[model samples]
Target: MAVAAFPDPDLDPSRWVPLRYLNFFRLVIAGLFLVAGSELQLGHEAPKVLVAVAFAYIAAVLTLGFPDAARRIGLDRLIMLQVVIDIAVLATIMWASGGYRSGIPVLMMVILAGAGLVAQGRAVLFFASLATVVVLAENSWRFFSGRSSADFLQVGFVCIGFFGIAIVARLLALRAKANESLATLRGVALAKQQAVNERIIRDMQDGVLVLGADGRVRQANPSAALLLGVDSLEGRLLAELDESFSDFRVRCASADGALQRMRASGKLLRCRAVGAGEDGEGGGGEGATLVYLTDFEEILQRMQQMKLAALGRLTASMAHEIRNPLSAVMQAAELLTEEKRADVQVRLVRIINDNARRIERMVRDVLALGRREEALPEALILAPFVASLIEESTLGGAAGRDVFRVEIPARATLGIDRAHLHQILDNLVANARRYCSGKPGSVRVFAVDAGGRTALHVLDDGPGIDAAERLRVFEPFFTTHPKGTGLGLYIARELAEANGATLELADNAPGAHFVLTGRTQP
Candidate 1:
């Protein structure tokens, strides 16, 4: 979260830094020319105007340029101008004092080295070549004017020196530019990859906790905070999150990677902790334990659903055998009522009827899953539909209907199949009636308009299913009731989806709650 401290990889050299080096070099070289001229006193025939011009050029470069403001004033061109002026001033001072014998060309060599350090590949060679031209022109004039000058032998040696300096300086400048560019690109790439990694970890639904060596939370995702029922856990001790996790953490420290359960608040969480390996970023678990937290039944429920989906076709194929036999058994049981049956025979017939009904429900659920029906939506006034459903179910002698309560907006509407919607409501109502205690408002129906959709909730006042069991409530053939065929919820969800709606189990502790969300009119 402290991302602001990360350094920017694409570094740019400060304009003042390079400019200070250039200006300081030029000023000092100009001063040396003046001092050397007075000390050597080698000037005899050359005019003093050239020395004055050189001094004026050096003064102009130093006084008029502000290196700190180089960004606004084109710093590269300014540096190039300084190089050109350095060449011209060096030539003027050499001609005015002593053209070939002044030993001032060594100073010119310093400028060449500085150019190689700061300038581009060709720029360094360009500066050195310009100096070569200036030196040749100044010495030629001295030779023609009958001033004390060296022969062709000395001139050839100086030309060779300038050639070698230009070639070597250009190569070094080229290499430096390549290395600097490579470093900058690598930095930018690293920053981008880090950003992507952070985004992925943040968006994950499973709780992620990073703990220090002392078992204090170093970093935690929002899911981790919610799983442990804490507002935040950045600096909290891991033992404080859940006392049940102490043994789990100890086992994890052994590096076995076994899953463990931790009971926190009213929920149970399945967790696994991983310590940093020897080659990991933490270098052998001094810090940074990656703990993954998830509800145990939730993970198991998902795995079961995946298995159910693959077996749905096979179950549907078996539905034909299951359906015909149940119908035959129910028919035979009804026909047997005409006989003079004994009391035990009556009980046996009733048992057959009940079991047949359960088998039929299970087969219907399989059919619904394997052959998914396409949705057919129609707009309907929501408040009136809910009122009618309540009235009809009550008049039909639905047990526990008297305890039902309703809350819905008057102007609500939904676009869905009426029959499919009714089926979903029937399942939820039956579920509520079976579970709600004999108390007022024990079964409540509420609808909320969420702009694009309406959420219809059915709540019951009873000991709610455990958090782990709640995750598998909608799974086929998964139920705690010995007489129940868990397909009621599975079929209900399928029917809801066939009408462009969704069925969901809501996490409402101390009570059971379900929601059926359907799209509303635009």
Candidate 2:
């Protein structure tokens, strides 16, 4: 049968531990032999030589045990050399103590077994054979010299026992090493999987929390911390953090893992609690609970956006039908204006034209929403771009182009679609012009660096937006002005996002401020 291969002890530091243990066993055996030689009548043939050989063996074992011995002599050669010394010294001791009859030859079994375990594979069989030959030679020499009786059968049995023990020890050692390697690999795989899971949970948008049976937090992700409005929730009691959490946990537990809702940081959160098991039984073996939190307001906004998208598509499909009749009404109003109608008739025709134009603008805005185009990004320097855009704005021409102020760094840049930027700026600048005092700096446009990004700010010197209307400012069909179409700001924000940008309302004390933050490099 083929022998199993094992790792080298020199390369695998942990395997060297067994070699140290083997050396310690040698020391113990040598010590016992020394004490026996001093006190006991071991044999009549050279008792003094027995004590001398024991002392020599002790010195050899101690010398071989130095830390650098393995590195200098090489591990395999070192172990082979130690086995040779053990056999030669033990055989000498046996010959002095009456050969095979003194029972000293039995110590060879321990030496062979230690060698087998420390140096596995074919080395084990080599140690076993070497010890058998040395002991048999010692027995033969003693009998031929007439110093002891012939005991070939006893010597043969000891040799057989040596081979049996060595083979068995070597096999068991190989099994143990194989199992250890498998365990190490499994541990590494489990650690990597745990790291990936932690990263996913940390970056997740929804909140995740782990709570012990005692209702103390065990782990919390960043999203959970933000949703709960706390710096950290780990190791803190749920009730201490907020009564809403305490009540939510109780309700989820009572309802047997049903979804629940609770108010946190003035926002409604959709919450669910589950145990560790696949079935989500609230009290698994660990008695721990996994809780998930989602923003109910965000869910509502998504539903509203779906409704608005559907409404926009429907209006777009009927836009042509509506505009055809509206065109006829506007043409008839124009003819009436040219005919020099009476005062009341002229007033009615003017109102008709104005209402018809408003409807046409509404249809055009709805169609634009339905035909949301993919953005084509390009690099744009902010200062020149803002200056040119302000000059082309409808309100800028009436208010005088110089009335708008631009403050951008010489190298400030943005990665956004040109047409998208033009539309967004037109809406914002028009709003600013309508509200701001007709002064050069009443409408200010500036850009600032923001963490490798660029933020373009547009502010007007007018009464700031009321807090109540701020929340609805970005909603479609919502407006504070009588003649304004509510879709302007909403469409502007949408266009910004289509180009990987964000349009946000900033808290400015004296005027309405809008900031568009986007990529700095293409």
Best by TM-score: 2
For candidate 2, what is the total of clashing residue pairs? 0
Give the poorly placed runs of model 2, Cα more than 4 Å off.
1-11, 38-44, 254-264, 278-285, 311-522
Q: Residues 265-293, candidate 2: write the lDDT tens digits.
A: 66667777777573544433377888887
Estimate every model's Cα lDDT from 0 to 1.
Answer: 0.70, 0.79
TM-score of 1: 0.50
Find the 10 residues in a row with the least total lDDT in model 2.
1-10
> In model 2, which residue pairs have backbone atoms overlapping below 3 Å?
none
Model 1: per-residue lDDT, tens digit, 1-522? 111122223324533344466666677656655556566553434547545765786676655355333444455665677678777777766776678777657777877776666666477667878877777777787789887776767766776687677678667756766887888899899889879977887887778888787788888888788777778899988887777666666565444345555555455566778766633347325666778777666778897898688677557645644665577677767767765768756776877777787776766666665444555678877778876887787785545456788888887777777776776787788778778796767888888987679888898898878988987897766767776766778778877776767889887745889988888852
